[model samples]
Target: MPRDADATKERILAAATAEFATHGYAGGRVERIASQAKSNVRMIYAYYGGKSSLFDATVAEALRRMAENVPPRPDDLAEWAGDVFDHHQRFPDVLRLSMWAQLERPEATAEPSEAYRDKTLAVATADASPLSPVDVLVFVYAIAQAWQLSPAGLTGLEEATDESETVAARRRSVVIAVERMLQKGP
Candidate 1:
């Protein structure tokens, strides 16, 4: 039986994704990623060059997954916001990976890629508003991820009381906020 190079690469990426999510770029160890993937560190180095390159590939894959799974819905921004929230809730690893990239390698963060641009452009409403559709989407995304990324300011007290309730309340707030913003008509 022959080993599949693509399958091995996919396994490596999946392992690296989990490692990076758990430890960030500075803290994550390629050895651990290789061990977990049941592959060798040399294979990772050969396939990805090094930790930094691996991180970049992981980030790119995460962004691609997000763009594919949570595309914009201009006809119903509120629904889109909900969908984003759901996606984040389900895939917190993506957010964690992104946070690591932003915090550890701020300069590396670049403008939105075309994968995101087309979707954002489609969501742009035709109105003379100060905020662009992308801006609105960013705000809505922030709202949806408030609890996940950082909630000390958003619901520190409520979170202390009941974590589940706090999360539910925040998710509701995200939907309502996006709905109101969309209803404001551009």
Candidate 2:
């Protein structure tokens, strides 16, 4: 594509990501994405086909970026979990987009991408845990995202004034939990 077209597509994806992350597929608005992207509806349609397609593209792009930015460190699963926690903290929109996708497109979420496959394989090869590789991977991810995904009421740190300290504590907990899980072979 031409430079202008590429820039326009990137803008559309960025706007669509923000829209879908906040509103989900059912509530996301194509017109709003178009307006935020500084592009017209016709161009969005021409580039992405329609609302659903654009949403899918946006989610795919988000996942791709996450995978690229945070590739698993199978040898050091604890630190890997911490990295995952940091990634979610830094890019809360990605987590929101993922939650929206899971809620709105359950069937699509089960399809394993190459990134997942690679992570699973790496875990299986690097660890000697009795638990299955998939289980190990899932547990690490769950622990890493637990604090972020939890309801505000469940997070007892609501009264905390120093957000950085709260985040650091949570991240340390995530790393410790993953390390214990690996050590216990569960």
Show model 1 residue runs off by greater than 4 Å: 107-112, 125-130, 152-156, 159-168
Best by TM-score: 2
C-alpha root-mean-square deviation, each candidate? 2.8, 2.1
Q: Residues 60-152, candidate 2, lDDT per residue (tens digit)?
A: 888889889999898898999999999999999998999999999764455438889999999899864678999988898899999988988
Q: What is candidate 1's lDDT per residue for 74-123, written digit by digit as tens?
A: 77677777788888888889889889989986543453477667766776
Give the runs in model 2 whose Cα sits over 4 Å from its true position: 1-3, 107-112, 157-161
Candidate 1 matches the true fold with a TM-score of 0.86
Clashes by residue pair, model 2: none
